[model samples]
Target: MRKSDEAGTRPDVVRIWIALGLVIILIIAAAMMLVEADTQRDQQEQVASVISKLSTVRARLEGAINGNLLAITGLIVEISMNPEITQEEFSRYASVILAQKTEIRHVSAARNLVISHIYPLAGNKKALGLDYRQVKKQADAALRARDIGGIFVAGPINLGQGGRGFVARTPIYEFSESGVANQGRFWGLLSVVIDVDKLYGVAGLTSSNQTIEIAIRGQDSSGSDGAVFFGRPALFDSDRALLDVSLPHGSWQLAAA
Candidate 1:
């Protein structure tokens, strides 16, 4: 009851204060842990959402790329039937199909590795005479495309037509005049240039409300491996959602955060 006793450091009194302080500290710690648990849960949920979004975008974008591949298939077939496929005919077929695929900037055909026909050449005359094999940057890709004997893709390179994009190339093997089924020889290539920014925009990474960042790294269209054709390469190494894009002729790694 005395002031001295009230202020005294009695063993029991010290024990009482220590117990009370311990209770308060425990309560604060539990509350903080609960808040942290909620925060971690929310963060995990956001990650799940982003992963789901990435799956949807991957499917959609792959479909677009496949559609481009198919469009060129028709041209490839026609050219196979007649390696001398007319410029007028090629332009007609390509203009219509390329018009349907907004991601594709241009469609072209080459004979013996020479640019023989190109659709929408109005803005691409510079490409008409440009030989892929003649250029250092394009030669390896061109040769690889020819030897790989499949649909190849190259670039994230600047176009002679005046833009940055990717080119998808497929070797065209045509039958000889002898009309032998097995005697078909490698004729040339069918190339399509895809607008990178526009393609990613379609992939939903460029939307005004887009939040998830994405990147890709894989074999380029020219049969070169371990190249980051889209987005940042480091993102592939970072913690992100990874999806595999199965192309008609190849595969690529897709990463999203």
Candidate 2:
């Protein structure tokens, strides 16, 4: 081969190599795009799963709380009907209630802001004669129940009996001679103590640690404005799915990541 012929062939070889390099680059870019798409899809599916679990948790939590809170209405009715009811009757009624509701720690009746009667009075003996006016932590909730003439749920606060729990209270009014409830005549407060750990267990929040991260705020049913009572506090500050848990008298915030 002559020199001119060899130089022309070298240029042709270089051109072929450049074209092959461009094809390889294109293939790599396409593969990278497919991998990115798969990653995004997986992330989306995980997010959807977490959100579904969050909804279920919220429903279970609200149902357990509201249903248990409603159970104490019978005791409230009994006291309203007979303000002079003795300890024997109170104990009997409360015993029946506690037997049915496993989440309830104890039930008590506060006559004029002072706890007078409690059922299964073994561990809860200290709660007897407890004056709400004297306890700064519990005074507001106790007073609110009376003033509202309706139900008020308080805590995840330290209980007088022991441990942490929620206190559900409603104002009780005596019946008039005509059998009508005397709204103007204040009798006292009827309260039910709900165990927090047990309630969380019933709500499936504790078992969800493996799949989703959850946190609850709005202690005392104060909604999003209140402090976190469950899970990590940082969850509320990050990008999370927020839900409102409706309570007897207020709402709480549930956050999930």
Candidate 3:
């Protein structure tokens, strides 16, 4: 009878051990699911933060560009009214504008497709007498600005003066003797060189950002159809936040991850 009881107790103990093993397995699976859920939540929050930063940068960049462009309008008006503006007069006026807006590298005027007047001619003397028709890269945009009778931005391209910058070009039509702008008489092109690094720094897009990686494409404001001008090209292919930078003639695509 005692031997029979021991056999029965052995089976009961085996059953209890099996049940404990199953419970342990379930607990581990649940813990893993919770960890995965937490990880996903964290990733979503991180992505949200990056997107917010990108939006803020976009606004700042646009504001900086538009502000400087608005300032250029006054100079354009002056040039339109006086198509015979001399280098000395142009330099003096440009000096005042530059003094107010430090981000502007230089201001130039092209009369009959020939670059004639450039302000702060110290470093930019090389660009003087540059013929827009001769330069293939810039010729198209310059012509487009004239034909469209509006402002067209080009580059982040290699400049004759040195370095790379965005050139905002607007067709300057001469004012009639009656003090009215005559679209029929296209006097020249007015261009302003924006310091790329300074502009980016003002927009908080310099290399100082450790958490977010940013890339800008759409050279010449061609939007996604254009090449990458800032940051890595691969960034656009990745799962990144994208925004369109509204420019004068076209748009730039901004990506952040």
Candidate 4:
């Protein structure tokens, strides 16, 4: 009888241990799952924060570009209205616009794709007669703009005026003749160079205080594919805010990370 009782007690003890072990295992598994869930939530929040910051950058970038573009529009209008528009005379009137929008580093008028007149020529005097046809880098964009017979944006290249920046060139056409055939005769170009470095300041995209990175690429007037003008061009490869920047006769790809 005593052996039987001892045997039963042993079995009971073993069962109790097994039950405790199972409870311990379950607790550990639950804790691990909770930890994983918390980690995932944190990661999601981080992603959200990054996206929000990128959105802000995108908006600011668009505003800066659009605002400056308005200045360019004014230049085109001024030149379009008067074919004989001289740089000096135009500068006297357009200087105020430049002062208002400091992002425009310089405005130049090209006669037959040659730099003829530039506003505030004190620093850019060297570009006075530089022909786009002679400038290898600028020549392609120049010819394209002329062939397109419209405004095109190119560069962030070493400008003839010195330093690196973007040039928005619009081929001027002469409608001097009365006939419809001569109404669209090609004239010259009115271009504005936006300083690449200074553009960050104006666009408020100078710092990377957010998770998402921002970049810009120059594309042909028809599409969003070209060399990077600013930031990591690879950002465009990943998920990003593809902002379109309208130029005179072209556009740019603004990638916000």
Per-model CA lDDT versus the true structure: 0.79, 0.87, 0.88, 0.72
TM-score of each: 0.78, 0.81, 0.83, 0.75
- TM value for model 2: 0.81
lDDT (tens digit, per residue) of candidate 2 on 1-257: 99999999999999999999999999999999999999999888877787788999999998998888778878888898888888899999998888888999988899998998998789888788999899889899999888777888898888655678998988889876776654546888888989999999999888856478899999888998998999899988855478889987888898888
lDDT tens per residue, model 3, 1-257: 69999999999999999999999999999999999999999988987898898999899989999998998888888888788999999998999889988889999999998999998899888888999999899899999988877888888877666677888999888876676655448888999999998899899898566468899999887999999999989889965589999998899988998
* Candidate 1 residue pairs in backbone clash: 153-221
Question: Candidate order by lDDT, highest to lowest?
Answer: 3, 2, 1, 4
Tell me, by TM-score, which candidate is best: 3
Clashing pairs in 4: 151-249, 172-187, 172-188, 173-187, 174-185
lDDT of prediction 3: 0.88
Residue 134 of model 4 has an lDDT of 93
Give me candidate 1's TM-score against the actual structure.
Answer: 0.78
What's the C-alpha lDDT at position 106 in model 3? 94
Off by over 4 Å in 1: 1-11, 176-183, 213-237, 241-257
- Model 3: colliding residue pairs: none
Per-residue lDDT of model 1, residues 102-170, tens digit only: 999988888888888988878876677778789898887778778877777776788766768877888
Which window of ten consecutive residues has the lowest lDDT sum in model 1? 217-226
Relative to the true structure, candidate 4 reaches a TM of 0.75
For model 4, what is the alpha-carbon lDDT of residue 130? 83
